[model samples]
Target: MELRRITYENVDAVTSMSVRDEQQNFVAPNVASLAEAYVCVDNGYAVKAFALYEGDEPVGFVMLGLGYMGWSAPPCAEGSYCIVRFMIDQRYQGRGLGKKGMEACLEYLREKPLGSADKVWLSYEPENTAARELYHKLGFIENGEMCGEETAAVRDL
Candidate 1:
């Protein structure tokens, strides 16, 4: 598998993604328009997007954005933290790819720098037990309390 920049060709892969993937994010608009409007390419946003391909076929995706210098801190920085949108193809969900995908993203974040922020943050619906457990097993600690079922989890990078 390989990770590459998201492009118009992959937008359809994103938009038409199954509900299992779609429920994680409101995958709206056509691929072309979404690509055109993405924040990842903005030099100052510290937001990057990638399409994961197994050989030549796009299999999944991840969208990550930076925040401040604190864990779950306010989001007003150029490259302090990363708020992520991670997803895997429904067909590949139960496999280890989701964990692998998040790990890949974390590895990418860890290479950013020493001061940009070392805490990795992600939020998910409380009912999404699979993801919460996946994250917890991966060593992400819950941030003391739940935030409307959209509890926040963090890991030190």
Candidate 2:
């Protein structure tokens, strides 16, 4: 799978992606994430919003905010990026796309302009065990922090 930048040609499909009912509370919709990305951009942060694709098909959306240096933003360690939002379409659930998409996100985050961070932060609702486990397997450890009602985790790059 490839994580391609969201573009006019595929924006519709990307915005249509949604998670399964049980997982809905774990993530926000793609449209909301895209809007937030724009806001981040206006604030001088480098935001990457991607449409995850399997060949020609859009499978999910992933958004990242690089070096969020805002004064009142969550306390991200210096030079850290955050996977602000990520989700697989409800129809695509159980196919391992989430894991694959996440791996792609990590790869994309590790390169130059976006990859200058020494760490990456992501958070999930404490009730979202699947997210917690997936992140743990990817080497993220609880940093004893919170993003609203979600517990935060960090992974060293």
Model 1 agreement with the true structure over 1-157: per-residue lDDT tens digits: 5667766777678666553544544322334334533533443435566776777877777766666322244232334455455667777777777777777777777877334676777767777777788889888877655433467777787
Candidate 2 residue spans exceeding 4 A from truth: 69-73
Predicted structure 1: clash tally: 2
| Candidate 1 deviant stretches above 4 angstroms | 21-44, 68-80, 113-115, 145-149
Clash pairs (backbone) in predicted model 1: 66-81, 67-81
Tens digit of per-residue lDDT, candidate 2, span 113-138: 56567789988999998888889989
Taken over the whole model, the C-alpha lDDT of each candidate is: 0.62, 0.82
Worst 10 residues of 2 by lDDT: 69-78
Clashing pairs in 2: none
